[model samples]
Target chain A: MMGLRLILEQVSHAYRDLSVLDGITLTAAPGEVLVLVGPSGCGKSTLLGIMGGMLAATGGTVSVTGEVAADCLNPLTYVFQDFALLPWRSVAGNIDLVLRARLPKAERQARIAEVLALTNLTEFAGAWPRQLSGGMRQRVGIARALAVRPACLLMDEPLSALDAQTRDLLLDEFAAIIARAGTTTVYVTHNLKEAVRLGHQIVVLSRRPGRIRATVRIDRALTDRTARDPDLLVIGEELWRMIRDDAAAAERERVDAPA
Target chain B: MPRLEGPVHFRAAGFAPKDRAWASAATLLGLLAMWQASASFGLIKSLFLPPPVAIATALWHLTVSGELWKHLSASLMRLFVGWTLGTVFGVGMGLAVGLWSALRSPGMAIVAALFPIPKIALVPLFIIWFGIGEGSKIATLAFGVFFPTVIATAGGVDNVARGLIRMGQSFGLSTGAIVRGIILPGALPAILSGFRVTTSIAIVLLVAAEMIGAERGIGAFVLSAGNLYDTDNLLAGIVVLSVLGLIVAWIIGRLERALLSWR
Candidate 1:
């Protein structure tokens, strides 16, 4: 299946007087992962929202091109940072939530089973989200997103809520899933290691009114990258160096500001 | 090797008070026994307290003569019809107020204005409007329950996570589907607990409405018995009301368990 390509043409946004995103132009190519990395308050999430059409840009336009599969229920789906699984729904029930509206009962069950199995959650289909650990809950989130066979997946810091060990484990699993599905994905996070490990194209944004400060391209396949690779580790450090001053400035500003 | 000394003073122990069913039963039984002993020893006159035994005897005679059933069925019917009407309308209005921005301010303003007025004080006014019969009685209970139910339901809707609703929309679920699948279930815990409050309010208004007008309800029976200086039957009616409250609370508890087992 050919994934849809999302093109942002000089998109910008502001919350009333405060401009959050400024002249952000980017493209998430078909069947590639475009990772947006930035410091806090840098509108990476806002950009993702604009790309997914969940939020309209106050300026410029976001256009979608290319074909999506006929069975795709949602062409642009989100994997939320908080892992927004309904506490009342079982793991399978949560995945079924998205599919039940479009698919027949038999097809819905099969799709749920496929995604659950893809996320290594086959044994947890009956478990409530509260009963699962943070990592497992996120697995349900990913499974739910995949159940729709989304043409373009928009993930917003999906691993930030998990612990270091679980994040590492799920990061590897995410790389594998993205590789296998080959769906155009726009991932937003502050973690350079994740950007290096999963991104085909990494775009770094400036602080506050987030602009595209730098764009780094990595041509290596997602599943082939590793945590300890020298070249990728250097890329991670380089990305950090690009954002270090903004990160430190944003941090101290946050400390001084009233909550 | 130095070890952690003296069990670290066991500082984390206390403050976790647990409910003991046996202790609860024992306390009630002990209180009743003391009251019975006081009555038997003539420490208190039966004219005032009527003791546990006298109350039970009166209850037995009332049940045998089917007078308790008459009063009970009447009160139960009023409670059922009035509370049901109030709840159905209350939930509908609450959802509209909570979901729609246009309705939120005006609905809340109206609710805030009406909710504070004492429902019992409105009984005579209701009697003039709905007439001096079951009409007035049910109206009193329904009016009493409606405000609190609306408040609880709207609060429940407010507490449903915005993230969940956004997730539903992102997945392209229809508006009706989102309300049914996410908003309704998310708000249910608050709504069910609200039932606990509204049910008790219904009972209180039921008693007040009956006392002011009706001839057959437990409240009316208790009021007449008190006027006649019959302490035994008066206490019997009080026990029946208390038991009814306990039963309703128990049913609500069972419902919470069944519906919210996920929590």
Candidate 2:
């Protein structure tokens, strides 16, 4: 799939009087997976939203590279933390939700089937979200996004809602499916292991009123993401150190503040 | 590897109707027994409290003579037409107010201002406008049903998750598509529940409207029976009204089951 590269420049934002993000810049290369890791309230999600064009950065420009086809269903799509599957819709129906406008009836069915197979959700296509476990529901959420054939995917803690075991089990599947889809993605998470597992470029930000702390590039192939490489762990640890101090400071500040 | 587990369903079995029937039947039988004993022992005057047997016999004659059906049919027809009208317009207007920002406040203001006023108090106004025929009765029921439905429907729409709507917009879905795919179904549980309230309101309004200047409704029969002091027929009319309410509630229960199987 043709992917889009995103570029952010000196982005800063605030909610009325409360500041959230400071001047910061980053580039997500085409077909690259960029993960944003930071403490809670670091504005990683705000940055992701800006990149997805869902939020307008107050002071800077977020742009994309490469020509977008006029017929693209969505150049940017999001997979939410809550799965956000329409409970009334079946798995296949949920996937078809995004494809209904992009393709005709027969072609839409084919696309849903293809996404279901990719996400390993083919067997439960008729199942309602209420009938699926948390992990499978999130898979359906991913499948719905994939059916849009988005050039860029923006995810906000997609697996954080799952239990640790489910997150661990689905990590490999996610890496493989996303690898196959080949969409440029900016994933926001606080989990360092997940950041290292999926991101080709890990961009770390500091606490509230977040600013860039560090950026690390991993040269490992997507296939290698399936196994826990020592180098990846080292990079994960380095990334952790970058934010640990800021996270502790943020926590202390929260505690010391008036309730 | 993924766990390969079957889909986990949130299926819960509701109480069987058969299990519920016996308890209700017992309570009814015990009440009937007490009334029969009171009447037979003359603890209360027959004119004041006719036994269940007398009421049942009156109901039997009304049924055989088809007098009960005439009033029942008229009342049911008004309830059906009025509630259906109210629900249709209520859902449509609710969606309008819910989706379009321009209409939200004015519509809500109109609803809030009008909803609390006693609907029965407007039957005289409705009669003047729509006439003393079935139109006024239906209009009264419709008016009573409309306000609560609008509140419930708009509330349901407002409660639909903003995240899902944003997701739809991100997927390039048009407004209409988002409403159909996300909004309406999301609001359905609330909308269906609103019907429960609206139907009961409609029945009350129907009876009230029928009591005034009408000759063929259960309300009229009850009023006339009361004037003549035919306590048995008066009680029979009350019993018919109770049965009508039960039937309406039962129909609504069935509708909820059919429409909300997804939940």
lDDT of each: 0.94, 0.88
DockQ of 1: 0.88
Tens-digit per-residue lDDT, A1-259, candidate 1: 4779899989899999989999988898999899999889989999988888789899989999998998898999999999999999999999988987688999999999899999999999999999899999998999999999999999999999999999999999999998999999999998899999999999999998999999999999987899889999999999999999999998987899998
Q: What DockQ class does candidate 1 belong to?
A: high
Give candidate 1's fnat, 2 decimals: 0.93
Model 2: per-residue Cα lDDT over B135-165, one tens digit each: 9999888888888989999999999999899
| Model 2 chain B weakest 10-residue run by lDDT | B10-19
| DockQ value for model 2 | 0.61
Worst 10 residues of 2 chain A by lDDT: A65-74
DockQ of each: 0.88, 0.61
- Please report how far candidate 1 places residue A116 from its true position, in Å: 0.9
iRMSD, all candidates: 0.5, 0.9
* Clashing pairs for predicted structure model 1, backbone only: none
Residue B93, candidate 1: Cα error in Å is 1.0
Model 2's TM-score against the true structure: 0.93
Candidate 2: residue B32 lDDT (0-100) = 90
